[model samples]
Target: MNTINSILFIIFFLGIIGTIINRIHLLSLLLCLELLLVSLFINITIWSNSYDTLISLNYSIILLTFSACEASAGLTLLVSLSRTHKTDLLIKLNLLQT
Candidate 1:
């Protein structure tokens, strides 16, 4: 169980790093963000089970709600950006002027 938790932590950490370093596309960034949320949910579940408590479970539920909101917002932004720019590539966005 501990090993599994450790692996999840490493995976989550790597996912965050990958999201930061890889600017391939907006879709990939969203996917990575979802991956991070999933890893967090799993980690929270593992800890909650180990501790035999409901508090962590409640927290996990809240996390899931936030993740859903985050995913929706990201997709909305992606749609708007793609419609305006005709591309999902991060390099094409003009952040300074926008």
Candidate 2:
């Protein structure tokens, strides 16, 4: 269980790094975000199981709900942006006035 938790943490860290290094596609960014969220959920579950508590489980449930909403919102935004711009590249989304 400890090993699994460590692996999950590593995966979460890697996801963060990937998100930072990747600035090309919106989809990839969203996927990385989801990966981070999943890692968090897994960690929460593992701790809850280790401690035999309900609080962490409740928090995990809340996190899951928030992640779902985030994913949906991200997808909606991506779809709208793609429809308007016809591209999902992050570099092409320049709305700042210059």
lDDT of 1 at 66: 95
Q: Evaluated with TM-score, which candidate comes out highest? A: 2
Query: Could you tell me the TM-score of candidate 2?
Result: 0.94
The residue-by-residue lDDT of candidate 2 on 1-98, one tens digit each, is 46897799899999999899887999999999999999999899988998899999999999999999999999999999999989999999986844
Scored against the true structure, residue 28 in model 2 reaches a CA lDDT of 94
Cα shift from native, residue 47, model 1 (Å) = 0.4
Off by over 4 Å in 1: none
Evaluated at residue 7, the lDDT of candidate 1 is 98
lDDT against the true structure, per candidate, is 0.92, 0.93
lDDT string for model 1 (33-73, tens) is 99899999989998899889999999999999999999999
Q: Candidate 2 — which residues are off by over 4 angstroms?
A: none
